[model samples]
Target: MARLKKTVAMVGMMGAGKTAVGSAVARALRVPFLDSDEEIVKAANSTIAEIFERDGEPFFRARETEVLGRLLRGTPCVLSTGGGAYLAESNRRLISEAGVAVWLRADIDLLWQRVRHKTTRPLLRTDNPRETLRKIYEARVPLYGLADIVVDSCPDLSVEEMAGRVIEALRQRPDVLEGE
Candidate 1:
């Protein structure tokens, strides 16, 4: 079995396949898969959209950080975070210190295609969601670039294929993965 030395935090846009690809990566690596969003939802007993609608984004963000820190302090697994998780300096520092951040980079169009029909995204509930997504993409790319590794996403790539790419990228950092 492949040994994971640190938590592999998957950071990217809303539809960048972080959860799907991260789950596959964890399975391939024989590690657990933890999603911050899911954790938050579980703790609050509500969906992310509900959390945002009731308590506000700040509240949700605090919960996100708490969940991330809690998970990172536990086992070395693949952790998928919400799109805005990496934007906060505190979150970035926490992730960098305890885990390795892998940015699943996808183009604006691909991200839009994947998320356009999803009503779960609270951030994209604007008058023009595509434009809103574009703006978000522009703002977050630099922060996402701060990740330790970057795995490019393509429209043609399957979730398994993307997971394979992440595995290859993790292989470059022997301290992160062993017995690859």
Candidate 2:
């Protein structure tokens, strides 16, 4: 079968289901799914918390950049990045130039409902996760809006459904998939 020259990317808040959706999309496209955070963990041989504690966020972020670039260099995989990964100017430009960046949008209320009890996420570290999410959401909304595509997604929807939407959107914007 044929494949898209450029891969698809899912970006949004922490609970936006990028990893889940990206995985499904990759399966649907008969491609691979790569979670940048997971790749980082595998490379560093530690959880994100350990990376943050031992190396600091800046160091972890630098590793994140390298990891993102490395992942992009491989086959066109549907990559699910950390909440702040795409926020970096270099990473954003890399995605925009190389792949189809899709933003998954969800309100803070929905985000809180979905992210509750999700301890694996390092960014939500706070006395009040809801407030932290809200603030982060507000700040990142504009940057997320810069994506090539946007989807209204919440935890209520299955990852497959969201991935279907992403595939459809990218299909519509064939220009983004030029090389493949």
Candidate 3:
């Protein structure tokens, strides 16, 4: 088994399989899996959409940052973040200092296919969700590019296969994943 030396922060769009693949990776690595969004929801005793509706995005983002920072400082694990979490420079810096970010790159079509029917996404409740998703994708790609590693997501791939691909990428960095 490969040992995870630092937290693996999975960063990408909402439908890019961050939580799914991150959990798989954590299982494979025999580590705990943590989702920042889940933490926020637990703390607030509200769903993400409710948070957005009640307190707005800014407040949710602030809580996200707090959860992320606290989680990253703990033992190494797989951490799945909200889509907008990596957009903040402060969060990015904390991830860089405490862990490695893996951007799950997926096409807009794939993202839409995965998320279209999911009402849980607070950001995609717009009048034209497809167009809204496209706009968000365009705006965030550059920031995601700053991650330490990039794993392209294939629509045809199973969650385990994508997790394998991410683990392969992490293996290249000895500082992150040590020994097989």
Q: With candidate 3 superimposed using the best TM-score fit, by how many Å does residue 25's alpha carbon deviate from the native? A: 0.4
Best by TM-score: 3
lDDT by residue for model 3 (1-180), tens: 689999999999999999999999999999999999999999999999999999999999999999999999999999999999999999999999999999999999999999999999889999999999999999999999999999999988899999999999999999999999
In candidate 2, which residue ranges exceed 4 Å CA deviation?
154-156, 177-180
| Poorest 10 consecutive residues by lDDT, candidate 2 | 171-180
Across 45-134, the per-residue lDDT of candidate 2 in tens digits comes to 999989998889999999999998888788887899999988899999888777778898888888888888899767788898878888
When superposed on Cα atoms, how far off is each prediction in RMSD? 0.8, 2.0, 0.6
Query: Model 2 misses residue 54 by how many Å?
Result: 1.6
- Model 3: CA > 4 A from native: none
* lDDT leader: 3
On a 0 to 100 scale, what is the lDDT of residue 82 in model 2?
Answer: 90
Point out the higher-scoring one by lDDT: 1 or 2: 1
**Ranked candidates (lDDT, high to low):** 3, 1, 2
Q: Evaluate residue 59 in candidate 2 and report its C-alpha lDDT on the 0 to 100 scale.
A: 97
Better of 2 and 3 by lDDT: 3
Candidate 2 lDDT: 0.84
At residue 141, candidate 1 shows an lDDT of: 97
Q: How many angstroms is residue 18 displaced in model 1 relative to the true structure, after the best TM-score fit? A: 0.1
Model 1 CA RMSD to the hidden true structure, in angstroms? 0.8
